[model samples]
Target: MSSSWPYPRWIAHRGAGKFAPENTLAAFRLGAAHGYRMFECDAKLSADGVLFLMHDTTLERTTSGRGTGGDQPWHALSLLDAGSWHSRAYAGEPLASLGNLARYCLRNGYFLNIEIKPTPGLEAQTGTAVAHAAARLWEGAAVPPLLTSFQPEALEAAQAAQPQLPRGLLLDSLWKGWLETGLTLDCTALVCNHALWDSSSVLQAKSAGFRCLSYTVNDEWAVQRLLDLGTDGIITDRIDLFAPGS
Candidate 1:
């Protein structure tokens, strides 16, 4: 049997391009409309312990709600207009919970890369909640979403809670013994910022039998370079730039 990971080359960032309300179902649908079959989203826990899609530490930037996201209850967070900040046309777009996103993706045969964006002190809680929720949401599906995080503690907690789900370690830059850190967390892949990858890094990850994926690549030349270097996948914000056949 082949032991390759199943993932699409083109993944929409935070759902669609940044042109839409990021992390909203609307953004995901927009990407899908543009022929994207895979998506990457940020997952975090609300004050009441609900796992939801969000990227920032606070709500001021992405939503009408105020204060830190970790300090607000789900009731308050859910009511905030998460879309209006992006554009007036997207006014009143609601926050999407992890459960909702999982259902949407699974039902549509879409692949997902769920990045665990836990609040500083709530790594364990966020990991546990996300894993458990994913386990429940994707029950009986053909393929489960890939869980990932930059936080080692969060990945550890997620592994302990749900070992069946695949996990990846996200890195902004490589540090001393980065391979050891990935091994410690039992990651199946290493998702890094685009500029950090080179032929040596790709070879090292391949030698370790781990998939290498790069994020936020939007240019044609960069994509071509990554492909030439044998990257397993490219996570891009320019969803319209490439498709299954293009």
Candidate 2:
């Protein structure tokens, strides 16, 4: 792994994961209040191609709206109650756009990791759009947001669209040609499930010119193991439990 990693060691997942509404601005604020400087969020396109923050393909789980999120235009999607599903405290929280998130992060001088979560068949298109939008949004910034995705096609499209922005390959398993794929895409980091990283996996990723990172690591043992393994970054849901910069 390179020694010049610029992001924080701890990143709040989906803006705070279970603490607030996943991928909503409220969750991001909660994560920030807990002292997290870096955050991870899922980005996908609306029917009209507006980039927005959301985790699921369907809105039923996290919002009051029904049907596929990508099937709806931004005007309609923006009106959905994204936070009420979590709790009444965050009721009426509108869906957050990529522009809104960019403004918030830039104002706070924070870092971001945006996962290119495309709706089913729109992976390549969504990836391209997100990359272009992010390039414009973060122009002239010192640290560009790290673009990551489990889909190679999405990452490939993002790379083709914005070569300057850093990218990472997210893996839940050590699939065939995983390392070769990361190398092919010119990924800056290899973000894997926390359990996937051992001494061997760490060495393999680091030796192949990619920083090692873990996702959704919440337990004390998982955090300690990654630290002991000398990983570069950790994405976690327990923002309240793990203090950033400690």
Candidate 3:
């Protein structure tokens, strides 16, 4: 690890992803059981200004609830069954709040990569809300969670809200203006798609003082490629496949 870099090399996607119902407490516990020290999960706001976990704009995919998740308050969103959609064993699991996750991860010494997933037309609001909430929740901690987003406006809002917390710009492709956008946002790192990094691009980003990371890297070939490039971090859904600190 670099001197200024203070995060794990491997981060569990949405807290164990395919292994457990994602974004729930059960998923985080499962990730810990699988020996993951750092986890990546999505964070967005509900109608009532509460920070909660949910990846999609609608809840039908992960939770039993339907329609827009951000339209409902925490009181309604928390009671829904967020786990049963995956399996019967995790049937009654309820949605967890940002505070709940913070307490659990802090108590057990785990790191977090919080992806600010905003609802449509509310990107800036969601990013600022999540950042402020994370800053408050992680108060007095030695290190704060790394906030990331594909939306530059959101990341900019996060930077404005809490400059102390580190941020990363997520990119699915090497757009023409991506490097400038990340630098403009004052991000500490750039998280890109697995295939986005190569020998040349990795060197360029590193030389420019940007830590490069890859996401959704679940295969051996992808892992080897990233390892060869000396990428800073890897987020994967295959929690059981690649052991942390290996």
Put down candidate 1 lDDT per residue, 163-206, tens digits, no spaces: 88989999999988888888877888999998888999998988
Which candidate number has the best TM-score?
2
* Model 2: per-residue Cα lDDT at residue 125: 100
* Candidate 2 deviant stretches above 4 angstroms: 1-3
What stretches of model 3 exceed 4 Å from their correct place?
1-3
Cα RMSD for predicted model 1: 1.6
Q: Top model by lDDT, which number?
A: 2
Task: Give the alpha carbon lDDT tens digit for every residue of 50-69 in model 3.
Answer: 98998999999999899999
Clash count, candidate 2: 0
Candidate 1 residue runs with Cα over 4 Å from true position: 244-246
lDDT of 2 at 194: 91
Where does candidate 1 have its weakest 10-residue lDDT segment?
1-10
TM-score of every candidate: 0.96, 0.98, 0.98
The better candidate by TM-score, 1 or 2, is 2
Q: Candidate 2's residue-wise lDDT over 78-160, tens digit each?
A: 99999888999999999999999999999999999999999999989998999999999999999999999999999999999
Please list all clashing residue pairs in model 1, or write none if there are none.
none
